[model samples]
Target: MGDILIVDDERDIRELVADILEDEGYTCRKAANSGECMAEVEKEPPSLMILDIWLKDSDMDGIDILKIAKRDYPGMPVIIISGHGNIEIAVAAIKQGAYDYIEKPFNIDQLMVVIGRAMETSRLRRENVELRRRDVEPPELIGNSPAFRTLKSSLEKVTKSNGRVMLTGPAGSGKELAARYIHANSGRAEHPFVTVGAAAIEPERMEEVLFGRESPERGIEPGLLEQADNGVLFFDEVADMPLGTQSKILRVLVDQTFTRVGGTEKVRVDIRVISSTNRDLTQLAADGIFRQELFHRLAVVPIDVPSLDDRREDIPELASFFLQMFNRQQGLPLRTLSEEATTLLQTTIWPGNIRQLKNMMERVLILSGGKGEIAAAELPGPDAAPADDQGRVVLSGSLATLPLREARELFEREYLLTQINRFGGNISRTASFVGMERSALHRKLKSLGVVTSSKQGARIAHLDEQPAG
Candidate 1:
C-alpha cells in the first residue's frame, strides 16, 4: 500500500477524497490545514501528496507546499486539486512542481488516472532509493587473484569519475556485477543504476525499451535514460545492440539530452553511463557490425576481464566461497569441499571463470542436496582424467610440449567441452553441475566459438566449433 496525504479545509471534500483514496488501495492520511500538512510531512514523508489550493489559513498556498516539497525532497511527486482549476492555473501548477492538477467536483475516473500516474512515478522513485541503499551496503565484490585484484583496483578508479566505461569480458565474468560495484562506489550511488542488457533484449525493439513509447491515452512519459538522470545507465551486451542504436546511443553520450520516441522537445539529463559487451567490439567495428565512433566514445576506461582458466589458482577459494554462500542460503551444514573435490576444481579449466566455480558447488550441494561428505562419485560426472590422489587431472606431459599458458588453455578448453557434452549441451544444468553463471557459460561457449543448437537456445558443445549458419 502507498502512503498518501490529503490536505483540504473543506471537511466534506477531505473525508470524501480520503475515503475514495482508501478504496483505491492508498493509505490515506488527512490534514485540515497547511500547518497540519507540513507537520505530517515532517513526521514522515508520504509517497504522494494531494493538496487543495484553497485553505482556511491565509499565510501560504498549496502551490507553495508543492514548491517547498520539490525543492527539499527533489524527486517527490505531488498532485494538486482545486474547484478553481483553469488551463492557465493547471499549466502554472505543473511548472511549480505539481505533477498533475484535477478539478474538484472530482471525477473519480480522472482522479484514478492522475493517481495511477503519480503512484507509478513514486514507485520508480522508491525503487531507485532502495537500489541506492542496497548499492551502498559495502563491497560484495569477491576475489583476490592477481587478475581479480587488478580488476578491483581499476574499479576503485572507475568509481571515482563521471567517465563512461566499456566492460569487455567473456560471458559470466561478472561484468554487470563489476559495473554495479562501480556505481555503488561512485558519486551517483544515491541515484538509480538502471540496466538494459542488449543481448537479453531483442534487437528489433531495442528503441522502445531504451527510449519508451507514448500512446495518446497513456500520456507522454520519460525513457530509461531520462529516468536515470543524475544516475547511471548500465547497458549489458552493448555489442549485441544494432549498429543504428550504437549511433543513437553515441549521440546521447555526446549530448546528454534526448526526445522521447514521439516527442519534439528535448528532455535533457545529467547521467553517467557504464556498458558491457562480451564480443570483440574492435573486430565488430572492423567488420562494420559496430560503429567505430561509438566504440571510441564508450571505451573511456575499458576493463578487460581475464578468462576463468587464466586465474586457475583462485578456483579453490572461489569454490569454497560459493560453497559457504550456498551453505548459508540453503540453511545446511557448513560443508567443506573434499580434498579430491578441491583438486578436481583446481585442475579443471573454468571456461566461465568465477561464475563457473559457483555453479559447480551448487550442483554438488543439490546432488548432495545437503548430505555429508561429497565424494568424486557424488560429483555429476566422471573424475578428471589422469587423476591426482584427489581425482583432479595431474598433467604428466612435459612443459616443453606446450607453453604453460597454452597448455593451461588447452586443458581448460578440453575440460569444458567434455562437461558440455556430458550435460548434453544444457547450459543451465551444465552451469549448475560445473559451478558457473549461466550467462558466463553462454559467453564461454560463444567466445570458445562452440555451437550446439537445439529446438531451444543454442550453446557451445565444443570449444573449436563455429558460429551457426
Candidate 2:
C-alpha cells in the first residue's frame, strides 16, 4: 500500500477510489476538484496521484493538473483517468509527462494494474534518467560502417545546398531525426521547421492540413507548408500522401507555388522540401501508386536511414541514455543493467528499431521491482501490445535461445500480415490496430513488398510456405 491522491470533481469517483485504496491498506486522500488537488498536494504530496481529465466544474483539467504536478513534483507519479477522450489524449499526456492514463469507467483491476505499473515506472525513470540526455544537438551522424560513412559524406554534400531532398529507410530507422539533423546542419537552422506524417492523417482533409484551406466545418485555418515558408517542409512517408495531395506536392516541388485549397489565388513560398519514406517511390510510381514526377523532384539526393541492427554498437549508448531518462522519470533507486541484460539488449533484432527499444526500456523500467538493475524479464517482449486489436498475440519465445533480431523481424512481418488478414486488408484499421498511421502502413507494404492473400498463392498454398521475414 502506498500514499495516493484521488482528484476528481465527482464526489462518487473520489470517494470510491479513496475508500478502495484505504481499504486496500493505502493512505488515500480525496480531492473533490483541482483546487483541492492543488491544496492537497501542497499539504503533503503523495506517492502517487490519480487524475481525472474532465470534471463537472473543476478549475483545471487533468492534463492541466498533470503538467502542474509533473513540473512541481517531478518525482510524483500521475495516473490519468480519461472519461470522454480516447488514448490519443492519453498518449499525448504521456508525451507531456503524465505517467499513464486509464480510461473512464475502468475495471478496478485494470486501473489498479495501470496504477501499480505507473508508480513503478515513475520510480524507475527517476532512478535512471541520468543515463539519458534529451537530444538537442545537430545531427551528428555517428557510424563507422562504410555504408554509413558514405551516407555521412552524402549528407555533408547535401547540407551545402538547399535542394529538395528525399530520405529512405525502414520504419523506426530515424528518418525524422535525420531530417531534423539536415535542417540543423543546413543554413536554415534558424528558420521554422515543420513536419507532416501524411499517413497519420485522414485522406478526406489531407489537403487542408498540408497545403492550405478554409474549412467552416472545423473552423480551421490554412495549412503548414505556407506556415513553414523560407524553411523546410518535411513530408514523412511521402509515398503515403493521398493522390490529390501528392499531385499538389508535386506541383509545389516543381514550381514552389500553389493555390491555397478552397482559394483561387496561387501562393508562392520559398520552401525546401525534404521527403522521407521507407517505400520505394520509383516502384510505387511504376505500380501506379505514387506520382513519378514527385519522386524525381524530391529524390534528387536520396539517403537511407540505417536500421538499428546495422548499428549494434550504438545499443549501449542508446540504452544508457534511456536508462538515465527513466531514472529521472521513475524516481526509483538508481541502477544499471547487468551484463546479461546488456548482452540480451544488443542481440535482440529490433524489428521496430529504435522506437521499439525506447518503449521496451520504458516497460522494463516500470516492471522491474525497484532493483537498481534491469533484467531480461523486466523488458518488453519483442512486440508492442497491439493497440486496436484485442485478439492480437505477440509472437513470444525465449530471448536467449533464439537469434533475437532475425526472430523479431520474422515475428513482426508475420504478425503484421496476420493483422492485415484479420482486418481484411483495410490499411487504416490494420495501422490503427498496430498503432501506426494508414500512410505509414502503406509505406511499409510498399517497402517490404508484402503479399496480399490473393498474391500469396503458392506461398499460402502449403500454409507453411509463408515469406520468411
Candidate 3:
C-alpha cells in the first residue's frame, strides 16, 4: 500500500524482493548499492526501506546509510537484512534506528508480518504528529452579509472540481480562510492542506522551502510541494514570490513534477494549487515582473474576496462569532456586545478587514473583566464621526477639546478622506499626491479608518484582467 525501497548489492536478491513487494501491492524501487539507495531516498522519501547490511563495493555500507536516513527522515521505517548475522550486528542496527533486522534465511510469513507491523507503526507515528499539528480547529467562514454570501457560494461551487483557484483581495480579508474552506470541502479533504506564505519566506531559501533540498551533510529535506502531494497547496501572497521561485513553481504546476535542490531525480506529485494575493498579478505579469504563463496556470478560476468595508452589515454577527469562539477557547464565561457597541462596530471602517475585527474582539473580551456585557467605551479607537452634507467629518470644535493625539488623528482622518474623495477614491493617485508609497498610503488610510468606494475598488480589481497572449 506504500512505496518501499530495497537496497542490496546482490542483483538476484534485489529482484526477488522487488517481485515479492510488487505482488503484495506495494510499490518497489531496487538499489544495487549505497549510491542508488541514497539517490532514491533523496528523490522521494519512501514509506519503508528494506536495506541489506552487508553492501559490497559501496563507499558507505548499509549501516552508514541507515544513520543518515534515520537522521533526516525519522518517520520512515527501515528494516535491515543481512546474510551474515550476529547478536552484536542486530543490536548495532537497532541502535542506529532500524525498525528490525532480518537474517538471510528469514521465513516468508515472518518477513511479511514484520513489514506489516512496521507499516502500522509508521502510520501511527505520522498520525500522532498530525494530531499535534492540528490541535487548533480549522477556521470557519463566518458571516451572512450579501458580500459574504456571494463569496461562500462561489467557494461551494468549486469544491467538487479540482480547478486551480486564485483568491484576490486586500490583506487580512479572509483569503486564507476561504482557501481552507475549499480544501475542507473538496475531494482531497482527507489529505493534507499545506500553506506556504510566499512573501514570508526569504528569497534565498524560497526554492529550498518549496522544492525541498538534498545535501551530503544535511541528508534529504522534503519541501512544501512534496508535503502537499495528493492534497491542496495554498500559496499566500503569491505575488511576492521571487522570480526564480515563480518559474520553478510554474514548472511544477505544468508538469506536476519537480526535483529537490542538489538532486537530479524528478519527483512527481498530485496537487491542487490555490494561490492568493492582494496585489494585481496580471499587471505584474504584463510588466514582466511575474511570469505570464504562471499567471494563467494559477488563475484558472479567480475569485475576489470582498474587503470588510463592503460587508459592514455582517459586523454584528462576525463580532458575536469571535466572542463565542474566544469564550470556548479560553474557558471564560460567555459575554455579549451591547446594542450601542454593535452599532459602533458596524459604522466603523476596518482597514485590516476580518482579521483586525477578530483581534479587536479578543482585546475587548480581555479588558471587559467581570462585566458580562461589552459597552461602546470598551471598544478600541474613536467612535464614528458625524459626517457633514458633503460626506466629510464635522469636527464642530471637537479638535480643540481633544488631546493632541486625538486632534492629530481627527485632522488626518478628515484630511485623507477629503483627498480620497477629491481623487475619486483612487488609492494610487491619492498616494502620489500625498508623497507616499502606494503601500504606505494604504496602511495610513487603514489606520485613519478611511473607507474607499466600491468603484475605486472595482478599478483596482480591473487590473487583474488576463493579458493578451
Candidate 4:
C-alpha cells in the first residue's frame, strides 16, 4: 500500500478524510492550497490523490493542480471531490485524468469503495511497469570479452550524449540489453525506462497506442510518450513501425511535443528515445519501407550488438551467471558447470544469441535436478534439436543412479520441455498438448525454471533423436 495525498481548503474536511483514511491503515498527507500540494508532490509522489474541485481561498483552483499533477505523474490515480456536485465539473476533472469523482456530502462507504478501487488500479499500473522493466532490463552487462568491452566503451559515450540511439543486431543478440545498459548508466536511470515493441503493436492502432486517445467514452488517456516523460523510451524492432507512426515519432523528436489522437493540447515530454532493430534500417529506408528522415533522426548514434558467436569468450561467464540467477529464482540447489561443459558451450554457435544461451541453461538446471556438477552430456546440441516422435528423453551420464524423487522431477521436466518444443515454443499449443490450461502450464514452466521469449524462433531445449526401445 502507498500513501495518499488529500488536497482541500477546508481544514475540518481534510482532517476528517485524513482520520478516516488513517483508520483504514493508510498514511494521509493534507494540502490546503496549490503551493502546499505542489511542494508535497515534489517531495514525494503519492500513490493516489484526493483533490477538492472547489477550493475556496486558493490561488490555484483544483483543476489547475490536477492538470499539473497529471502532466508530471501521469500514472498516479486521482479522485476529485466537490461540494457543489456539478456534473460538468466532474466530467472536466475526468478529462484531466482523474480516476473518479465524488460529490461532497458523499457517503463514506461509497468513498471507501472508490478509494479501494483507485488504489488497486494504481498498484496494478505500477506492477505492470515493473514487470516490463524486469522483462527488458538485464540485471547487468555480463561479459568482459573484447567485443563486449568495445561495445561497453561506445555505450559509455552514448549515455552521456542523450541523443537518439539506434541499436542494430540479429534476433536475441542483446540489443534490448544494450539499450537497458545505456539507460542504466545515463542520467535518467532513476526515472522510468519504458519499452515498446513496434512490431508487436497492431498497425491500425499504432497512433492510438503510442500517442493515446481523447475518447468521449473513455476520457483522456495518456500514451507511451507521456508515460515515459523525463525517461528513456526504448523502441524495440523499430524498423517495423508503420510509416505514419514513424513520421509522428519523428515529429516528436524534432519538436519535443505531440498531440494525442483527437486532441489539440500538445503534450511535451522530455524523453530520450532509444530505438533498436534486427532489420537493416538503412536498406529499408533505401527501399522506402521506412521513413528516411525518421531513420536519420533515430540513427544519430548507431550501435551494433555483437552476436554470441563473435563473443564466445563470454560464454562461460554468461552460463555461470544464468545458472546462479535461475538457481536463486527457482530455489534450486546451486550447481557448477564442469570445465568440459564450459568448453563445449563456447564451441557452439548461438544463432539465437544470449537469450538462447539463457534458456538452455535454465532448461539444463531444471532437468539436471540441481546436481552438483553439470557435465557436457547434460546439455542439448548447440543448435538444439527437436524431440523425437515418442517424446522419450535420451538419458546421458548417470540418471539411473539418481534418487527416485529427483529422477521423477527430471523426467517430468523433460516431458514438458519436449511438449513445449513440439509446439514450437507456443505455450497455448503446448498447454493443449499436455492437457493443461495455458496459464497453469506457464506457471509449471516458470516453476521449473524454463524461460521462453515471445520472439519468433526462440530456442527451447529438446531431446536428441533416439531409437525406440
The 0-to-1 C-alpha lDDT of every candidate, in the order given, reads 0.75, 0.71, 0.82, 0.81
Model 3 lDDT on a 0 to 1 scale:
0.82
Q: How much is 104 displaced in model 2, in angstroms?
A: 31
Q: What is the C-alpha RMSD of each candidate to the true structure, in Å?
A: 12.7, 17.3, 16.1, 14.8
Per-residue alpha-carbon lDDT of model 1 for 1-469, expressed as tens digits? 7889998989888899889888878898899887898889999898889888878763678888888888887677788989988877787777786778888888988988778767765665665567666665654877555567778889888788899899988987888788899888888887878876577555665775577655433356566787788989988888888887788788888888776777667778898988898898899999999999988988989998766654554666777777788777786566777767665665565677677677877877776765555665665443344667886766656734998887876666666665654343466776887799999887776656666533222334443356554
- The global Cα lDDT (0 to 1) of model 4 is 0.81
TM-score of 3: 0.58
Counting only residues 3 or more apart in sequence or on different chains, how many pairs clash (N, Cα, C under 3 Å) in candidate 1?
A: 11
What is the lDDT, from 0 to 100, of the residue 190 in candidate 4?
78
Taking all chains together, each candidate's TM-score versus the true structure is: 0.56, 0.52, 0.58, 0.57
Model 1: residues >4 Å from true position, as ranges?
1-136, 370-373, 381-383, 386-469
Global local distance difference test of model 1:
0.75
Could you give candidate 2's per-residue lDDT for residues 1-469 as a string of tens digits?
Answer: 5789988888888888887777778798888777888999999988899888886677788888888888899888888886786757867777667666677788899887667655654443443242123224455454543345556777778876998788888898777777877788888776756667677666875776666654323222346777678877788888888887788777777778887677777888988889899887888999989988878888888887777766554666677777776778777445678767775676566888878887777767676656677775566544444333676654444433568776665666666666564344456666886799888876665444465442121012233433345
Global CA lDDT of candidate 2, please? 0.71
Model 2's TM-score against the true structure: 0.52
Candidates ranked by lDDT? 3, 4, 1, 2
lDDT of 3 by residue, 1-469 (tens): 8999999999988888889878999999989988889999999999999999988888999899999999999999999899899878887888788888899977778888879767855764575367436624655888765677789999999988999999999999999889988888888888888888776566886887778876543356577788889999899899989998888898998899999999889999999999999998889999999999999999999999998877765688889999998889886558899988876686577899899999999988777685678888788865466666897877667576999998897777766765564344567877886789999987776665565773443121133342323
